[model samples]
Target chain A: MHSIILFAHGARDPEWARPLQRLREAVLARRPEADVRLAFLEFMTPSLPEAIDAAAAVGATDVAVVPVFLAQGGHVRRDVPAMLETACARHPALEIRLQPVLGEAQSVLDAMAEVVLAG
Target chain B: MHSIILFAHGARDPEWARPLQRLREAVLARRPEADVRLAFLEFMTPSLPEAIDAAAAVGATDVAVVPVFLAQGGHVRRDVPAMLETACARHPALEIRLQPVLGEAQSVLDAMAEVVLAG
Candidate 1:
């Protein structure tokens, strides 16, 4: 099975995860059986490594991490890669991949533009 | 005239602003005459206050601040509102309004979901 992890910069406020949860729901809506989860960087639960382990426990052989950030900053560029490297080392049997930050995607940019214009 | 500020959390790396720049470009494409600008919360030039000042100097009577964040955490809820209050106080003539974070928008959430599913 394949697992998709939505990596986000978590905040102290519990409600901050609302968007990430919605994103997870959206992903699951397309593939009901897909193993999708949300992981945080700080001030939240389920760090990236923990989330990956959870997926691995469920017989997931393929894991794709999508950073739900708007841009590739230090967090996306320096932080996530380092964590992924350790995750890869720990799960030799798992095929792990990192996708472009959501902000980098053209679709997301267009959507943000539309939101601003709608106002 | 109306000015739109695509406010984002900037990083130390200059390239980190690429996505925000793209967002600004997209907004301009929709409205060529739009006085759109990009401002950072930290580690970048043109802080929110500076952007608001510049807009006011350009004779913009209305300013809309759109935070490119995914959720309404402390940064979005407390920090931004505090800054906006100060900006409003600084420029009494300018009608400064804050919009929902980009991540809070349904279009953006859907786009993010589409991105993950496309893989």
Candidate 2:
């Protein structure tokens, strides 16, 4: 099975995860069978490694990690890769693919632009 | 004239602002006559107050500040309002309006979900 992890930089406010949860739901709404989960870098539960382990435990052969950050800052560029390297070593058999930060995507940018224009 | 400010949490990496720049360009592309600018919370030029001041100087009777953050955490809920309050005091006649964070918008969430599923 293939799993998708929506990784985000967590904040102290419990409400911060609401949109991420909604994003996960939005994805699941389209593909109900897809195994999608949320993981955080800090100030929240289920760090990247933990999410990967959970996916591995569930017999996931391939896992795609999508950083839900606005841009590829130090956390996405340096910290994420370092964590992914350790995750790879821990689960040698699991294939983990790191996708670009969501904000960098043109479609996402266009959507945001539309919202801004409408507002 | 009216102005739009795409506000974001800046990072030390200069490249962190690329996507936001693209977002500003995207907004301009749709409305060539519209005035759109970018401001950072930290670690970058054109802080919120500066952007507001620039907008006011440009004869903008009203300005819209859009937070490009993924969620309404302390930064959005507290820091942003505090900053806006000061900006409001600085230009009481500018009629500054604060829009909701981008990630919370359903259209943006759907677009992100599409990107995640495509990856």
Candidate 3:
């Protein structure tokens, strides 16, 4: 089975995860059977490695990690890859694909522009 | 004239602002004459106050500050309002409006879901 992990840079405030959670729900809403989960870079539960391990344990043969960040910064560019490498070593059979950050997507940017224009 | 300030949490990596810049360009593409600028919370130029001041100086009677964050963390819930308060005091004549964070918008969330599913 294939799984999708929505990775985000977590904040100290618990409420900070609300949007990330909403995004996961949005994904599941569209594809109810999709195995989607949330993982944080810091200050929250289920770090990248843990999320990957859980996915592997659940018989996920392939996993796509979607960074829920506005841009590709050091965390998205550096830290995430390092964590993925470690996860790969642990689960040699699981194929993990790192998708581009959400903000980098043109559709996401257009949506944001529309929101800004509407406000 | 009204100005739109896209506020983001800047990072040390200069490339971190590219998505934000694209969002600004996207806004301008739809409305060529619209006045839009980017401001950072930290690690970049044109802080929120500076952006607001520049807009006020450019004869913008109103300004819309859009937080390009995925969620309302302390930075958005607290820091931004404090910055806006200071800016309001500095530019009493310029009506400043703080829009909701981009990620909170339903359309943006749906767009993100689409991107996730496409990957």
Candidate 4:
């Protein structure tokens, strides 16, 4: 089975994870067979290593990490990859793919633009 | 006229602002007459206060600041508002409105979920 991790920069506020959790639910609601989870960079539980390692333990052959960050900031560029490197060392057999930053995605940009224009 | 500020957390990489800039352009493309711009929280130019003050100086009676952040983190909940409050004090006549965090918006959540599900 494949596992998709919606990676985000967690904050001190516990409620900050709500939207990401909602996104995971939305993804799962559409594809019940898919295994989607949340992994945080900081100030939250289940860091990237834990999330991916767990997937590896569950016999997930492939894992894709999609950063939900608005831009290619330090967290997305430096911090996430550093954590991913450690996750890789722990699970060399896991086929992990990192997706592009969400903000750069064409659809995301269009959606944000639409919202701004509507106001 | 209505001025929209697509505010975001800045990064060291100058390219990091590309998405927000694109968002501003996309907003303008659909509404040519609308005045949309980008303002950063740190590590970038045109801070929130500067952007709002400029808008107020340009005779803009109404201004909307959209936090392009993914969640209700401290930056969104505390930092942005603090900046807005000072902006309000500086320009009392300017009708400044702050929109909800982007991730909480239904359309944006849907779009992100669609991307996750597509994977």
**Per-candidate local distance difference test:** 0.92, 0.95, 0.94, 0.86
Native-to-model Cα distance after best TM-score fit, residue B88 in candidate 1, in Å: 1.8
Colliding residue pairs in candidate 4: none
Tens digit of per-residue lDDT, candidate 1, span A66-111? 9988888889889999999999999999999999888889889999
Q: Model 3: per-residue lDDT, tens digit, A4-26?
A: 99999999999999988899999
Worst 10 residues of 1 chain A by lDDT: A68-77
Best by DockQ: 2
lDDT of 3 by residue, B14-100 (tens): 999999999999999999998999999999999999999899989999999999999999999999989989999998899999999
Task: Give candidate 3's TM-score.
Answer: 0.98
Tens-place lDDT digits, model 1, residues B57-87: 9999999999988898888788899999999
Comparison by lDDT, 2 against 3, better one: 2
Off by over 4 Å in 4: none
Q: Of the pair 1 and 4, which is ahead by lDDT?
A: 1
Model 3: residues >4 Å from true position, as ranges? none
Q: Per-model i-RMS in Å?
A: 0.7, 0.4, 0.6, 1.3
Q: Share of real interface contacts recovered by each model?
A: 0.92, 0.95, 0.96, 0.81
Deviating ranges (above 4 Å) for candidate 2: none
Judging by TM-score, tell me the better candidate of 1 and 3: 3
List of clashing residue pairs for candidate 2: none
